[model samples]
Target: MSEKMEVDTPTTAATEEKKAEHVTPSASGESAAEHPDMKLAQAIHKAVLMSSNKIPMDTAHIDTLKADLIKMSNPSLIESLASPLQWDLSTVDIAGMKTANETTLNELEEKVKEAQENAGDMEVLEARIAVAQFAAKSMSKKEALAMYQLVLDLPKLSSGKQMDALMEQSRVCSFYSDTLKNKDYIAKISKLAEESGDWDRRNRLKVYTALQNILTRDMKTAASLLIDCIATFSCTELCSYPNFILYTMMTNILYLPRTDLKAKIIDGSEILSVKDDVMPVFTLVKCLYDCDYKGYLQAMVEVESVLLADRFLFPHAGYIMRELHVLGYKQFLDSYKSVTLTSMAQSFGVSVDFLDVQLSRFIAAGRLTAKIDKFGGVVETNRPDLKNAQYRDMIQQGDLLLNRIQKLARVVDV
Candidate 1:
């Protein structure tokens, strides 16, 4: 054994502290079956060897070791140290050696990070799979769609499984008429419907899915399918768009002016005359075109269960639908706040000056209150107590406009 060896180097404070705690016992008590003088000699020898070389032992570490050694009584450790075994310092040197380029190691470390990220994605995929399975088993199309979306997002997921889950969600959602957030899912199902070759189901699904795609503003997909879907199926029972569909899509002047679908509106005018069932939808459509916010909101209330999907008139119409459906009073307040003279004028498709004059007449007749702002504009507040008498007189006089509303009601296609 060498009298002095520079074998160990401290890399960290904790390592240095551990070395001090374990080092002194190996040095001071280096012999057993020896007299006090011999033990003292061994301690001195260790002290000389340790002091001869600057090994960087911390004083704080040394003091801690000294205190610990006072309590421990393990003599065999001293005997073994007296005839100290040779340490394979080669192994320690190998451990201490590192790559020259810290950058290269950092790059390798980044690869390891990427692998961990992939592993996390795999876990997410697994979770999605589990959720999908649960949703399918429970027949919860909405929940399944949510899970399928997660599965579709993972780039590494098996395409076969992704497609399978997607199809499953699509089938269930179509059957239940559940809405999905992803356009791809809708497209996939529409294609499936086309391939399956069921005329009624396929055509309906195609139109519904196309509408869903439209709801997301994927106009290219919608345009691609609209003409084909309309041609493929008759709209007699299902009311597929630009024809029998009495929902909010045709409620705008933009829809009315479309030449390709103009005859459908004229047909709708006829449909209005047949049994008067479509009145609610026609009225809503008119309100939408007129931007009669309050009237539209009020009309929504007369319909039972606004939560019913078919009754959900607007496709992604936002708070306009939500407040009217779930919080009517709040929507009422918002409508009142949004009202202005220009709004009323635009609603009637007339000049602001003309509307103001009409409003002033109503105010003078005590049928409405003319709230004139300092900036020179008026808001009409209809008073039922005063207006009821006028409404009765109008009813008796058989006002042509009121008669038209009644006639529209007679042809209302519910």
Candidate 2:
């Protein structure tokens, strides 16, 4: 117990705040009687001593005990923490998958309850505890939400726990295509993260917020937030080279380019290098940036697996597909006044019939700015006069100037 003691500091305090969330709840909701002073030590020993043969190693709460156990020279305890994240004991026996998982889940639930009881009411463990329980049970969306909400509602959940709960909720809602619910949960999490003074979490929360905003009609806001996230995060030393960061950087530029961020993306390349797995995503962005329609389509096919596996990224990936297709069509229509559908298909790497349908969608959406002649198999581009384009640019610049001046006036008054 003496060796288990750590000096209490603000950082350690923050981490320990939700330490209770790792435990599964008891059926009776009553914790075993334990002395307050020895609770954390007891919980650590119990968790170590438990039969973890069937327990998945990805338990979030287990991370807290990692350093201490290592200091105590506990190799078996460390090894027990290294199983596949989604692996479950129940999945082993086909006949008893649910029953096995449920039994293990029940045991975890009892352990968590006792741990929390020993640790005291102020234990901030909802986030870790909720995640552990949810993973163990592998419950349906309805059941997960109900159980998770109960855990979330517990008193004294630390900011980290709250964010975890929100993130877990976000994942659940994402699976069900519950866009509105995802938006609400992320929005709440964003605010909580800000208040918690966890700068890293707050920055990452921007990604989630941007994702949900994209699901809604607020694309402009989403783009802005993504740009900010990419710029802020990429420039940092904290896990900056993740595939998602690069994707965000590229996606923002796909629809709206930010001058400041584009430079950061290039510089951060040296510090936070891209992984090989994310190469296709990078290529896709390059294609879009370079106006290489052929490459863009190829890169899209290449990154299909990455797009499907990433949850936060999964939803926005469609935008990339749709926008890139639109951009390709926009580019394809650029050099020709009229081109046969067959020629267009060959250039863009698709069937003539598919191009015809895709072109029609582009046309109907008012994106193509051209007409598809079905009989002739010709897709024509409608180019505006240079004089008209120049005039429109003049008006747009004037509007921007006027808005800036108005904003400046308000600042002056303040």
Candidate 3:
């Protein structure tokens, strides 16, 4: 009986060992479930399920929820969270809204082509057309332009509708740099703005045109238009750059005479709120205002790479630098009819030859009616008599007109 029990014990022990092996896997799984990463994943899962029960009605919240889920740093788990959010009933409702928007878009297609013989729907049509145009613009320019043309060609739009369409078209045309197209669009929009009699709309359109010119790096036109815009706009309008149009206007205007816009300019608080790259610009503006030539030059040098990399300011940057030189000389010479070149150079902290070259440019451009008395080493200002200057200008213009008339007559004779 003892021998039989010993043999049975070996078989029982082997069976017990087999059971231990099977239970070890289940024990290891339990240990893994206690791991920090696993615990975190489970916590995230519970959070998501809770959130799903009280999901936000707003679609914008969906992005926030997705962002929260991605923070878990577990690819397998992220996939699980992503899958549920993808087809969540809330998102499904968004798809329904999109379908309804598509139907509105189709109706807009017909409404744009035919005048609703009903005046009642005209206001609603305008609103719907605006929404449709924005959608089409995002999808394709060709489609947007067709809609724009339909609105523009409409013979009898309300001043309000015309203003809306013109503003939209002006803004859209700015995406392209075609001179002819921009000019044509500007002409049409300007006409519409004029007929609307809304001074603010006209001013805003000028600013829009100026911004397009800036994007094209046509600084002269941009500057001219911006100056006109500044005149038309209130001090409040020029204070901050809420739009690219305003931003370019304000930054570039810093280089111009600021006597009129002193209070209207962006301040230190405003500069701090802007980009680090723009800090150099504000610094340059300060240097300019303080008449700190050396500081201004250094600021420009510090930002030269930035200027070249920037599309709007790059083309005119070198010109602005030269303008600084001219401005320094002009301010220093504002009191002097004639001063020794060396003395002027010393006052402005520049070399005699350098000063001469800069002054020569101003003289040649007729900006400064002055002559370099090389022998006397003095710059003599040619103070023109106002009446005589006007007389000379009139004669020069008359001569140009006469020459054009003669050429036309000669062509006619032939």
Candidate 4:
């Protein structure tokens, strides 16, 4: 009788385990329920989902992105992910998604509870992290953020786990264009990565910081960071390698000295690798480097089209274009003491009057060190003398030092 009861107990437990495996309904024939790693699934789904929001250039691209999102989001929480897009219900099994969402959440909650009851502290933390990642992928932004914060608040969390949570939070903030929160999260991640000596995370943070700086119009800092990461860029979460190179080219072309631009960008292998993929941007840089003013202006139009179409670069399109023109004009003027307005205008593929007005505005604003001779129909360069500038700076610093010394003497006397 005892032997018979033991056999029956084993059979009953096996049956229940098999039934539990099938509890979560699979949506659209995808097997997300069977996937062991929720983070992997989330990363795959997020790559497509976040990209759809960033590349809103054309209707065709938008439609394509939406389709990809729908395909990847299946078997997870499709309804919440697709609800904002107002996608057609006929394409997805809406009823099945509701069941799947409920089942997945219930299963995750059970895992967390089970870990707390019987497992060690690390196991409980892992279970909670899984729940948080699932919420990030399937739930609304508010709920997802709350879940992540819960995981972060857990005691004895390692630096790596903390960084992982903060990075996911940064992605959520980025999706909503919550720049302030995203910046704060990245700063926290930066500090943690530095403390833990996580070189990969540190490198990835450079790209993240560069994107924020670009959006904020801090081109000098953005340009430096972007240029530095060209050879070791691994932040595919933010953009593709080709698109990363495009950004590097665009920002560096505006701020880098000719020698540095030539060495770091124009001659760099990474930029050359993607030259064909981003021809207009490549042309913009090449023409500027080669002093091909006419081609540079023509390429600027094409590059501007791309900039205006991009969601990230659109806001600063006008500013970037103006700066590029200023750079080109300044470079052209540097080679000669003076050049005729008609000749300079012809070189830049612009009208004399238009170039005159443009150069006048730049000169008046102190952006360009040149004088527009309306009477002589020439533009004279006023390049500052390095020696005289250095002398003036030294004298100013010396006077300031003497004032500081005099103040120190007065304090000593007192």
Candidate 5:
């Protein structure tokens, strides 16, 4: 009985040991509710679910992937997994390469043909028809007889908005250089201007261009051309107007500067006479400032009488008088008791240093005797004898002074 009891006790003990091994928990035996990794994964899944709910899920694949990502505790792995599923650009195929190539070639050919049409070769321009084309291209349909010029003959060259651009260009060019006046070039330019549709620009060019030709070429040709152009352009329906250059030229060559010409001249009473212009005024002032004593005295007397008689026409009288004083014009400065350096500088729009230089030079040359004013801010000068001698010498020697005097004489009504 004792042996049987011992055998049963050993088997019972072995059975109890096996049961204890099965009951004891392993490291991974924690329930999903208790495990920290599982809890973190669940929390991440809930967060991802909430966040992704608002975002548009474009595809079933994207929705499935987003659900999987929410379940992943390791968020860093999402980017690596996501890169493949995102927009697959390789699936798309573009097909315009051949079409684009054909289009570009056609455009390039058109551009070359257009260029050839506009830019007649320079060697070709040496020919008659080519030169005509060149001129026509400039004048176009804008003007009837106005031949415009170009920076170059190329159609792709510069742009101009005016209808008479070609005509103005040709005129400016002809004036700038004498070499542009080839007989062939002139004929071509004239023909081009004649073909232009614009009546005004055509007439203007016909008149001015003819004058240019006359001045540079021959008087007889100019006179004949002018008579014809004036007659053709004289019609009021064609926007006729008197050409100043044509009138001046005709007066010089045919009519002469006699009593009639003087009588016909525009006066200060006219709205915009040449005498009232800044150029003439400046020319007069510059002559006076250069110490042309007799010239100034004579011109001054003439100008003053005019100013006094026609004060309305001479609004700049006070300003001019002030400049004379500031420039150290002793006669005028002494004549006007109100003359002072401050007043002179204020009115003349010139620097005091310039005035000082003029005064010092005049004084040093024994032209005038200058002394500082009571205020210690200005200098004054006067000497009638010096003014006369200096002016007479200036009139004899200075071409600029002579031209200015002639210009003034031409502009003056008297």
Candidate 6:
């Protein structure tokens, strides 16, 4: 899907205005700086900036981050939101921000009181939501979280309103990189979305759940969720459409079976739509599916650059790269009962010694069903017998079931 596609219309006026102000893509398209979640955008820029101190980044990229940081740093917002990151805020107007925050809160308090007195419950709720949103956007993190809770606590809130409040809370958690709290909020949102049967919100919840899973390093679950939502993604508040596809390809590449990878990702229309925009990732997946080991290796380097530069993917870059190598080797080895180590290394454009050491590590870890013979200079594939494997699994599970049943009988006798 195109990033600019009108996936879902806002249901309420407040939601419409919110999208107009924050989520709408600019004419130049949605860049990181143009992300709807301001706090997440700030956090990403700050993360990249800090990573620069340890990793050598090009001057242009560093310059862009610095500029984006300055643009996103709001003095009136939470002061300590970026504290954990230890990002320099010298250029930000800390004192003026504090003053502005106090003034805004006092004004909002008066509005809430007026609404409560003269207007109906709905008006009061709307006023309170405004206060909470303001807090989320411009006040301290503690105050923002508290305000959102207040909105959620208000009685007679519709399912839609509850979902909105929960989503806002999730965004706040994400801004602070609170993965645990973010996951909790996502769970709440998921329940509400299902209860309401709001298809738009349900689609959005898939993206939210996928992102939370990614943060928790549950790549298999994340990949499943992302792949399922490829055609229905409408969560521009979290990320652009192209980026969503990029994430889908990245996570699925690590765990998806070859057939599913070929069907869903290799030939999926949604993925093909943004292939040019995310060419590196697409290239990596294509090379692996096509069994072009040399091409896959070359493409992996480019893909690694993209992964290392991403705030979400940076921590997992090394692991993902290593897994990709194992995946390539396992797929290649699957085609043959035994391939000479020299030939395998040559196909991957790597040295035989490097391939030998790499395969040995994975083999010992039980990640690959293969053995390497240093003396014979050959690698033997040990493909498991499917029926035998399933039978053994059933036996193990049956034993556990019997043990549980015996324990239950003893308790009954007691």
Question: What would the TM-score be for candidate 5 when compared with the true structure?
Answer: 0.23
Q: Write the per-residue lDDT of candidate 2 for residues 1-414, one digit (tens) a residue.
A: 111111112335656665434322211102211111122333343343333532223344455554443333323323433352222324233334456556756876776676565655443253336444444235455655666676677665555656655665665565445787887888788776544534455666666666666556466676677667654552121122364464465455456543443455433553246535467766766675566667778888867646544444455567767876887788667878999989888877888888889899879989888998778878888887899999999999999999999999999999
Better of 2 and 4 by lDDT: 4
TM-score of every model versus the real structure: 0.30, 0.52, 0.52, 0.78, 0.23, 0.83
| TM-score of model 4 vs. true structure | 0.78
Q: Which stretches of candidate 6 lie over 4 Å from their true place?
A: 1-51, 58-73, 76-91, 398-414
In candidate 1, position 209 carries an lDDT of 57
Q: Is candidate 1 or candidate 5 better by lDDT?
A: 1
Of the two candidates 1 and 3, the one with more favorable TM-score, higher being better, is 3
Q: Summing lDDT over every window of 10 consecutive residues in candidate 6, give the lowest-scoring window.
A: 24-33
Candidate 3's C-alpha lDDT? 0.52
lDDT of each: 0.42, 0.56, 0.52, 0.73, 0.38, 0.75
Model 3, C-alpha of 152: deviation from truth (Å): 3.9
Sorting all predicted structures by lDDT, with the top scorer first, yields 6, 4, 2, 3, 1, 5
C-alpha RMSD by candidate, in order: 34.1, 14.0, 28.0, 11.7, 42.4, 7.6
lDDT of 3 by residue, 349-385 (tens): 6788987898998989976767899888899877779
How many pairs in model 1 have backbone atoms within 3 A of each other, for residues 3 or more apart or on separate chains, i.e. clashes?
Answer: 11
Q: For model 6, how does the per-residue alpha-carbon lDDT over 1-414 read when each residue is reduced to its tens digit? A: 111212233346556444433322221212211223643554455455455564454556545644554454445333443463444677667777677778988899899899777877777777897788777666656778799899888776666667777877887776666888888899898876654535566777788889888878889999999998888776777777888898899999988888999999989998898899999999999999888999999999899878766666777888889889888988999998889999999999999988888999999999899888788999999999999999999999999999999999999999
Clashes of each: 11, 7, 0, 0, 11, 0
TM-score of 6: 0.83
Best by TM-score: 6
Worst 10 residues of 2 by lDDT: 28-37
